[model samples]
Target: MSATKQHPFYKSLTVAVLLVWTAAVLYPLVWTLFGSLKDNQQFMLGKPWALPKFPLLWSNFSYVWETYGFSGYFLNSAIVAGASTLLSVLLAATTAYILARFAFKGSGTLLNLYLSAMMIPMILGLIPLFFLLNEMHLINKLVGLIIVYTASALPFGIFVLVGFFKTLPRELEEASAIDGAGYNRTFFTVMLPLAKSGLVSVGIMNALNIWNEYIMGTVFINDPSKYTLPVGIAIMQSEMQYRTEWGPLFAGLLLSMIPVIAVYVLFQRQIADGVTAGAVK
Candidate 1:
């Protein structure tokens, strides 16, 4: 039996599967949104799928802000993620340019080394990293967190950028050179602009990763004031476990997600272009 006509049942089954998948994905976000508006009692007593009546959205948000010290955590997270992403992208761009454009002795070996580093699990490095950071007296500091985030992101960022840069036309560089543009000028004025989409994509990914990271932040930053969103939320959860205050927790979760979602939405076009270009090239 030749496909479509004979597989009418299969088509119906596929449609049903897709509907279920869509509901599965969307239900949690809808539930969380509703839950954020409910008090601790209502959240537990009401149906999981029910919408809130007289939604206490503002109260819940206010509670989260005060109870979790969310303002401080938000600022700390923004600083660390932003600094790390900026540093990583700049360093990645330079390193990627060298790897992609230059043909030096043992270039392949060096590239392979970078690739190999990616395979090593970050957890394995934590103990030694912590000890080293302690020696530098960087423990419990935002700078140390930024440094760790930058280092952790560098390998994958460089790998992605290297591929993107390699796909760029060499003719552009040669044309710039003929016009008396130096390497720095050509890279900054020509290549970087052309590669803006890729840089944005990499930077956004690094920002999200750093912002959500809990393990390293928890271990390295003992001060509550220095805690990022993830760690602060975790602390809130632990403290409120007996009472189980769902309202503030849900509100906090929603707040934590806003920046990441906003970034993806704002740069949606650039992210799409970057992925498409990277794939095509």
Candidate 2:
């Protein structure tokens, strides 16, 4: 078999596989969109695979947002996810920078400790953490949840950013020092900006994880008003047994997905580059 002939075959196979994969990924989203536009009668009596009927019910979204209180859930999620991501990235960047650049006693051990912490499942610590937060009078508070998320996200962020910091040229720091920049100045004005891609990757990943987190929200939040989107969605599901509102439920789901999809689409290039930055160097 000639190289050119084999190349075409592999290329064709790759394209075929990608096409199939794309369909698999897109079908559920399309189905969800169709489901969201439908009424309860359509789902109960009509074909499962049928397209949405005429006069799409866009009010489903408004109903879920206002009547069902997804607006509150969305706001809570945004605040928690945004705050946690910012704190995690800031702390991780500093910690990673120090660990990567400076060699001192116990620094390696500290880094290793952080790396090992990531290996421990969050479930293992949930019980103790709940009690600890309760004792601190932080349980059922957004502040508590934010603190928990920030702490939990730290290990992964540090692990990723350590590699990124290491990849950056030492000469940059040296050059900054020569220009009369102090440690904080150099880090903020020079090194941090250079690691923007890594920061973006870490921020987005942590945001997504926190936004979708249901277990913690359900466990810590007692007030319905304090519920995150995932917790809100779960509540909505439970209520479905008594009175199913499939349209609003699907609409709620679609609403949850939009921010995540938007983020990935906008910063996907940065994410790819950041993930690979550490590996290549």
Candidate 3:
């Protein structure tokens, strides 16, 4: 078959697949929205996929937010995720820039170490990490969680930003030098601004990862007040088993998803650009 003739068939196939995928992704969100507004009777008697009955229980959100400590959990998650994402992206940008541009001895080795770290399962270090945090008296603290999240996210950030830094023109640096800009000034004012897409992309990815992180939060934090959203949700699930507060449970889940969804929606263009940047260069 001619390439032109095959294009339509392939395009149609792609459209069909995308439609199916869209439905698959959207259904759960719709279901969750419906379920959050429902009462216990609706959950027990109504069909699983049924729309919520009249007089929607908007109080489900309030119930979870106030009755359980989801508000605190939300704040804790925000703090950890926001702080860690900022630290990780800043540190990664600087480290990646040095490695990509400076051409120092052992730079390749250091980058290789970061790549290797990415391959290692985070679970393997949990025990040691737990003990180390305990020794530092950082266990059960949000600051400790923030630090851990920042470190854990660094490898992926470095891996991504390194490519971005390498693809930039060296003439930018030379020009900055000609204008009497030093290394720090050149990086901060010239190159860093130029790599905004990559930074935003990495920031969003790291924020999402840290926000959704459960195991580390659950392990490192024992205080109920210190619980992140995921851990709080897990606790809410267990506590609701006897109460049958499915509405509040669903509401909690919806709350947890808001930040993640908002971030992707806002920065999706930057993410797309970041992915294609190296190829374009």
Candidate 4:
């Protein structure tokens, strides 16, 4: 509230800093977007920082989709990421609910186990998980990727939901019990709805994680036909054909980015509210 605190210089400096950060973050996306509108030769030879030539070539995206088999990759990623998010959120919510609802033996131990799992590097489990999936005949399949993503994401999801659930009042449970509702009914009808923000938060995070995952796809999948978007894009980058197709490659990058941006935009409010609510309660 002081004169110095409300100085125009301070306001100007803060605006300048934020503008710089925004440009730093958005420059790549803008570069990629404009580059995607040019022909490969023009894109590669021309100035990268400049605008694309007019009569914009939209064929790059189509080429990436049809000529490079990106459509299948997109579909595969959606299936894997979507299924993993659903399973991870549901299982994590149930587990967190149990831990938060009542005092039980070894509850602290169980919670610590989950938290400890988060600290373990996923790299350490890669070989064992590969062999385990191979034994179960889940290798080279999206289902196997789904299972892995779901399991790996569970610890984080449970940690977030536990915070939300612990903050809920005991009166909600007491009221449910008074209505003669069983545990399952009360949880699904009352407690679950109350945790909507937390669930959405975990769900969005897990979806983004699985969608963007490359290592899991690389370790498990062998068939090019079965490749998820990340794996497919990696393979494309490695291939000689895409070496000259810079425009299409940028087009592919933009395509891969769209779903992620959409998800964030759609659930952004929920994510903000959930994190804030957890902190406040």
Candidate 5:
């Protein structure tokens, strides 16, 4: 084997950049984890970099989970994000499949419309959306939020999955057709499974967006009982000035991050594979 030809300067620079970025991202999470074990005073007054005192208060998580209603909010967010991701990704995959496979009048237009929808800042639709939802009697409802989240996530999902669908070998669909599979059957059983990587990629992204989304969540959900985690956390933070339990607040924040982290940990390989495959094609 040829001796490794190392570009020392470039290698050193790359390592330095990675180390800096890693530290920047990791420090805050570490600090937050440590702060969760202390009370408000220690978090505020004690050295910000120090570890928690000997008797780390694990009850802080329980307190945030129960006393502050994060449990309900967390569950509400899970339902909203989960439902929205599933519905949006399913719709997007079907839409993408048709656009990628079929050549017909206005198919391009339809795809273009979804692409254009991505450019329109969701904020621009807020006033009209509110009125429309209110007229539909969906204000402050979890179902309303689910629909809103699903719709908001659709365009991006379609954009990503369309590329994957286009990249798929046409022979797969041809074979499925020769086997007497209809369009729906071919799509659901063959094409869909083939595009699993891209679907998971978009689904995880949509879930993360829906989970962490604040503005739409805050606007649509008014009842505290129905609040999603981000909105609920903001509400809790606002109330914290009066209650002053910083440790449990940090605990709540940490809990909110677990889902996104877990998703990336579990499906990161598929996400990377989907991205590069879509890109190369």
Candidate 6:
């Protein structure tokens, strides 16, 4: 068979696969968007895939925001995730730099210890962690959540950043050192700027994870005002007894996803470049 003839079949196959994948990914989001515009009558009587005949868009969003306390939850989520991302990335960058650049007798063992931490399931540590937090009087607080999130995200961040830092040319640091630059100055001005893409990628991933975290948020935070979006949304679902407010619930769900999607879209290029750069070396 000619190359051109085979290419068309391969192209057709790729298109078909992509279409199916897109549908699978978008169906729930589309359904949720339409559902958020539907009233109870439409939700109960009509197909989920169908658009609402009478759009209650503003009403659904208003109800969710006003009644469900989504604003507070959203704010809490943002604070926790943002603080955690900042702290985790800073710590990871410093730690990864040391691990990547320095050679010590126990360096390999230390790296193994960090990797081992990743293998331990979070659930297994939940009980002890809860007790520890309680003893420290950090329960039901944003700071506590930030602490947990930073700790949880640190291992992966360090691993990824170490790999990225290792790929950086040693000559740059040597050149800086010869010009009277100290370790801190060289790292801050030279390595950090070069590693911006990788740091951003790690931060975005950590932020997304923390923002949508449920189990830790639920267990640690009992205060309604301190609840993150995921826990708050779940609470909203549970509060509905006689009839579910599908419209408002879906509206809240859609609204909650906005930040995550926006962050990904905004930093997508950096994330892509970071991953590619890391992989190349």
Worst 10 contiguous positions by lDDT, candidate 6: 272-281
- Model 1: lDDT equals 0.87
| lDDT (Cα, tens digit) per residue for candidate 5, span 237-268 | 88877667878888999999988889988989
Candidate 3 local lDDT, 1-281, one digit each (tens): 78976798888988999999999999999899999999889888857679988899999999899999999999999999989999999999999999989987898999999989999989899999999999999999998999899999999888888888888899999999999999999999999998888898889889999999999999999999999999999998888677768899999999999998898888899887885674354
TM per candidate: 0.90, 0.96, 0.95, 0.95, 0.94, 0.94
Which candidate number maximizes TM-score?
A: 2
Question: Which candidate has the top score in lDDT?
Answer: 2
Residue 214, candidate 5: C-alpha displacement in angstroms: 0.7
RMSD to the hidden true structure, all candidates: 2.7, 1.7, 1.7, 1.6, 2.1, 2.1
TM-score of 2: 0.96
Candidate 1, residue 228: CA error in Å? 0.4
Stronger candidate by lDDT (4 vs 5): 4
Off by over 4 Å in 4: 1-4
Native-to-model Cα distance after best TM-score fit, residue 117 in candidate 4, in Å: 1.9
- Of 3 and 5, the candidate ranking higher by lDDT: 3
lDDT of 6 by residue, 184-227 (tens): 99999999999888998888888888888899999999998888
Off by over 4 Å in 2: 1-6
Compared with the true structure, all predictions reach lDDT values of 0.87, 0.92, 0.91, 0.90, 0.89, 0.88
Task: Write out the backbone clash pairs for model 5.
Answer: none
2 versus 6: better lDDT goes to: 2
Error of 4 at 160 (Å): 0.7
lDDT of 4 by residue, 108-146 (tens): 999989989999989889999999999999999989988
Q: Ten residues in a row with the worst lDDT in model 1? A: 40-49
lDDT tens digits, residue span 15-66, model 1 = 9999999899878877887888887667567565677877456698988898
Could you tell which candidate, 2 or 5, scores higher by TM-score? 2
